[model samples]
Target chain A: MLARLNVALLGLLASTLSFAGDAISATEKQPLNLHAIGMFVLFVSMTLGITYWAAGRTKSASDFYTAGGGITGFQNGLAIAGDYMSAATLLGLTALVYTKGVDGYIYMIAFFAGWPIILFLMAERLRNLGKFTFADITSYRLNQSKVRTMAAVSSLTVVCFYLVAQMVGAGQLIKLLFGLDYNIALFVVGALMMVYVTFGGMVATTWVQIIKACMLLAGGTLVAVLAMSQFGFSFEKMMGQAVSLHSLGEKLLFPGTLLPDPITALSLGLGLMFGTAGLPHILMRFFTVTNAKEARKSVLYASGFVAYFFNVILLMGFAAIIIVGQNPEFFEGGQIGGKIVGGGNMIAMHLAKAVGGNLLLGFLSAVAFATILAVVSGLALAGAAAISHDIYARVIRKGKATETEELRVSRFASVGLGLVAIVLGIAFEKMNVAFMVALAFGIAASANFPVLILSMYWKGLTTRGAVAGGYAGLVAAVLLVVFSKSVWVTVLGNAEALFPYDQPALFSMPLAFLITFIVSKLDNSAEAQAERAAFEDQYVRAQTGFGAAEASSH
Target chain B: MSTTASQNAVYARIRKNPRFAELVSKRQGFATLLSIIVLVIFYGFFMVVAFNPNLIGQRLSEGSYVTIGIAAELFMFIFFWVLTAVYVKRANGEFDEITAEIVRDASKEVK
Candidate 1:
C-alpha cells in the first residue's frame, strides 16, 4: 500500500513539475488597477525579504516544521488568528453578512467556537504529545506505521481541500480588487506561497501569518469604526440605516431571510464547531510553542483575537449594507443600475474605499492580498509536514531517515503542494469559494476531529478502530459532499442532488463516532488490549506533560 | 518500580500512585465539564437556529433594530470566550501545579 501510494504521488508530482510555471489564462488583457497592484507588490516584496532571512536561519527539521518551537504565545496567537481569518473570513464572510444579514453572524460565531473547544480539550494535550505533525500524537501508543498512514492520508486530504478553497478565494478576490484575471491572480498567489514555504519553512510562515493577522485586525476595526460614526455612534441607528438602505430592507435584519432551512443550519453547526479543531494546519500550531502551558496561552490569545475580529466583522457586514449599499459609486456600473461592484465579495473593499478613500483602499487591498498568501503558506507547510515528517521520515524510512534528507524532501513537498493548489484553485475559479471552505471544514470535522479526540480520551480506541473510523469518516464526508446540493446539483449540473442536504456532518459525524466505538468494543485481540492498557500512560503524559518532545532552543 | 524504564512500563508504576488517580480524575473531569458546557451553548443555539429561525430573527424589542438572534449569539460567543479564559486560568494555575507535584512524587517513589 505504501509503495503504491508513493508511486502514485510521485507520478502526480512529476506531471505537475512540467506545468509549474505555466501561463495563467490572459491577465494582461485586463486594465490595471494601479493602487491595488502597487500595494500588493509592496506587501509581496516585504514578505519575500522575511522569507530570505528565515531561509538562512532554518537549519534542522524542527526549524522547518515547528519554527524550532521558538514562537511566543502572543505571536502564535496572531499566527493562528491569521490562519483562521483567511480571505474567506474577511471578505467572504463580510459579503455573506452583507447579503444574508443576520444569518451571517451564526456562521462567524460557529467558526470562532472552535477555538474555545481547542483550548478546553485539545491544546495542552497536543502540545505535550506531538512533535511536528498531529500524527505524532495520534500514533504514539497505537501501531505506529498504520496510524501514521491513516493520519497522513486524512491530514493531506484536509490540507489539499483547504488549499484549493483559499486559492480560489484568492483568485476571485484579487480579480475584483486588482482588476486582474482570475487565473493570473491564482498563479501569482500560488507562486508567492511556494517561495515562502520552500525557502523559509515554518519560521517564515508563522511571521507572515502574524503580520497579516495584525493588519487584518487593524483594517477590519477601522472600517467598522468609520461606518459606525456615520450613524452618530449608535448601533441601533446604524442597524436602522442598514435595514432601510439594504436592497432587502427589514428582511435583511432577520436570520431566515438568508438561511431559512433548519437542517442545513444544524449540519453547518456540526461542521464549524468540530472542523476548526481538526484542521491539521491549525492543530500543528500546538507544537510550535515550547510546552503545554504555552499551548494554552496561544489558544487563549487566539480566542480573544478571533472574537474581536468577528465582532468587527459583524459590524463590517452592517456597515456594508448601510454605507457601501447606499453609495452608488460602488455599484458595478459605478451607479445604482448595476450590481454591486465586483459582486458581493468586493463589498468589504468597497466599504474600505467609501470610508477611507483611495489611500485606505490601497492599504486594505494589500492587507487582503497578504491574507491569502499567509494562509496558503501555512496550508502548504502543513501538507509538506504530512508528506515529509509523517509519510517519508516515519513510514517510508521506518523512522531512520536523516535530518538533512527529511528537510530536503519537505522542501520538495512544499513545492509540489503549491503547484497542486494553483491548479485546483484555477479549476474552481467560478465556484462560491466560501461554500468550498465550508466543505473543507465539514470534511475535517467528520474525518480528523473524531479520530484525534477519541485517541486522546478513549482508552478503548485501537488501531483497527482508529483506522476504520477515520476511513469511514473520510469516505462518508467526501461522498456526501459530492452528492450534496452544493456539488451534485450546482457544480455537476445534476437535476437533483443525490444527498438531501448541503452539510454532511448531521449524518457523517455521528456515524464516525458510532463506528469507532463499536469497532473498538468488539476488537478483543491481544494488540487491541495492549493498546487499551497503554492508554493510561498516554493519558498521564497528555495531562502532565511527561515524556513530551522538548522545544529546541534556537 | 525502578527508575529505569522497560520501554512503556515506566508509566505502569505511576498508574498505581494515589496522586496519579487524583490528578487524572480532577483534570479529566474538569475538561469533560468544560467541553460539555461549550457543546451545550453551541448546540443549544444550533437547536434554535435549526428549530426556530423566526425566534432568533425577531427584534430584541418592538422598536429595536437588533434581532434576538444577533443578541443571543453574541452573548453566547462572548460567553464561550470567557469560559475558555476561565478554564485556562484555572488549569494553568491549579491544574499545572498539581500535575507537576503528581509527577514529582510518583518519580521519587519509583527512584
Candidate 2:
C-alpha cells in the first residue's frame, strides 16, 4: 500500500520538474542512451544487493541511525566526502569554472574552508556529546521538549529545501543520461532512496556513498588526466590555451567578473564556511565513528579527499574550456562556441567524451546519477531521524518510547519525507527555486550554527535563549531570502528588493548570536539555574568521554 | 545517570583535577589558535578578491597565463588540509592522553 503511494508521489514530482522550464530544459526530449542506462542499471542492482545484506544487520535504533558506531574513521571519512561533494559540486562547479574561470576556483575555496575549522572546533565535542542526531547535543542539558522541537523544525526545513533541489536536479539528470521521462526518473530515484533508508538505513546509505565517492574520484581523475594529456600535462600550457579560447580572454583569470562587490563575496564566503559546519547530515557522520579519536580522523581524511577532488575538478574545467570549447560536435547543431548539448552543466561529460569517447561519458553519467542517489539517501535519513528521534521519541512521547517503536517511526518518517520531497519538487518546478540551495546554507549558518556552538561552549545558554535564537535565525534567513533579488525580483516580479544581498549569512548569523546571548543573560528562573548547573556534567562528558553514550557491542 | 550522586561526584572531581584544567586550557587554546589562523587565511583571500581583483588576476610573472589567485588557492587547499593533520596528531596523541589521565584521576577520587 505504501509503495504504491510512494510511486504516485514520485510521478507527481517528476511531472513538476518537467514543467520547471529553464532549470532543466537541456534534456527535455532526448532519446535513451543504451550505454548510460546499462551502467546505471548495474549501479542500482549492486546497491540493492547491499541493502539486502544491511537490512539483516539493522536490528536496533543505533544500527539504523549510525551503523552501530562500528565504522572505522577512514570509511566514515569517505562517506562524509561522498556526502559533501554532491552532483552540484561535480557538475555545477565545473560549469562555473568552465564559464567564470578563476571565479569558480574561488567558490571552491569557500566551500572547502569549512572542513578544517569543523575538525578543530566541533568534531570531538560533537562525537562525545551526540548519540543519533545533532538534537542530542543541543537538547543535552536544556528543556528537551522545547529544544528538540526547535532543532527538528530547522533540520526538516533545511532537509526539505535541499531534498527538493536534489530531486528536481535528479529528474533532469536522469533525462539526460537514460533518455527517460522526467517523471519516470523522479519515481526511480524517489523509490530507490526510500528503499535504501527505510530498510537498509545508515549502513546501506554509508556504503552506497562510499562506492559513489570512489567512482566519482576515479571518474573525475580519469577525465582530468586524459584531458590534461592533450596539453602535455603542463598547468601553464592548459591555462595558456584556455585563456586564448575563452570569450573573456585574459579576464578569465581575475575575480571581478563573478563577484564585483566585497559584501556579496564576504556573505557568500561566510555562508559556505559556517553553514557547512552545521549541516545535519554532515554532523550525523561524526556519530558513526567509535569515539572522539575516530571522529577527528574522519574530518582529517574527509578534508584531504575533498580538497584533492576540487583541485581535480579545476583541471577538468580548464581542460573543458580548451577541449569542449574548441570541439564542434558537442555543440548545438555543430555551431562552435555556441550552446552545449546538455546545457552548460554537461561540460564535464563532454570533456570525458572528447578524451575517451562514449564509454567514459557513460561511466561519468552513471557516477553522477549515483552521486545524486547517495546524497538524497543521506538527507532523507537525517530528516527521518529528526522526526523519529527528536520530535516523536523525545517531544511527543516524552522520552518514554521503546527502541523498537522508535525504529518503526523512523522508517515511516523516511518514507514520509521522501514523498514530501517528490511533491515539493513537482509543485515548485516553475518557481525559480535556484535560491533554495543558498537559502539552505543561510539557515544552517544562522539558525543551526549559533545555537549549536553556544550550547557546547557557553554555560549561560538556557532553553529560552537557544529556542529563541534558533527561531530568530530561521525566520531571519527565510525573510531575507524572500526579499532578496533572487526571489523578490526574479520570482515575485517586484520592482525592487527589500534586501540587497543574495547571501544572508553576514547579517543574520550575528543577529542570531546576539539574540541567543542577550536572552540567555536575562534568563533567571530555577529551570535556567538547573540547566546551567548541569552544564558541568555535559562538559565533562564532552571533554573526556566519561559516561558518554557508548557504541553498541554487536 | 548524570544526576546520580556518584556520577555527580565523579564529574565534580574531574573538574577539580589539575590535569583537567590543563587539558581544557591547552586544547582550547590550540583549537582557538588554529581556528583563528584558518579564518584569517580564508577571509584574507576573500578580502583581497573584493578589494584588489587586479592583483590576484595578474600572472605570477610576466607572460604566464596562470594567475597568482588560482595558484595561491590551490596551495591553500593543500595547506588547509595539512592543518587538519597537524591538529589531529596533537589532539589524538597529547590531548587524548590528558583526557584519559583526568578521567582516571576523577574515578579514583570517587572510589
For TM-score, the strongest prediction is 2
What value does the lDDT take at residue A243 in candidate 1? 79
lDDT string, candidate 2, A250-310, tens digits: 8888985568799999999999999998899999999999999999999999999999999
Model 2 error, position A139 (Å):
0.8
Model 1 chain A TM-score equals: 0.93
Q: State every prediction's TM-score relative to the real structure.
A: 0.93, 0.96
Q: Rate the local accuracy (lDDT) of all candidates.
A: 0.82, 0.90
**A342-423: candidate 1 lDDT, tens digit per residue:** 6667888888988889878888988998998998999999999999999999889988999999999999999999899988
- In terms of DockQ, which candidate is strongest? 2
* Candidate 2 similarity to native, TM-score: 0.96
lDDT of 1 at A422: 89
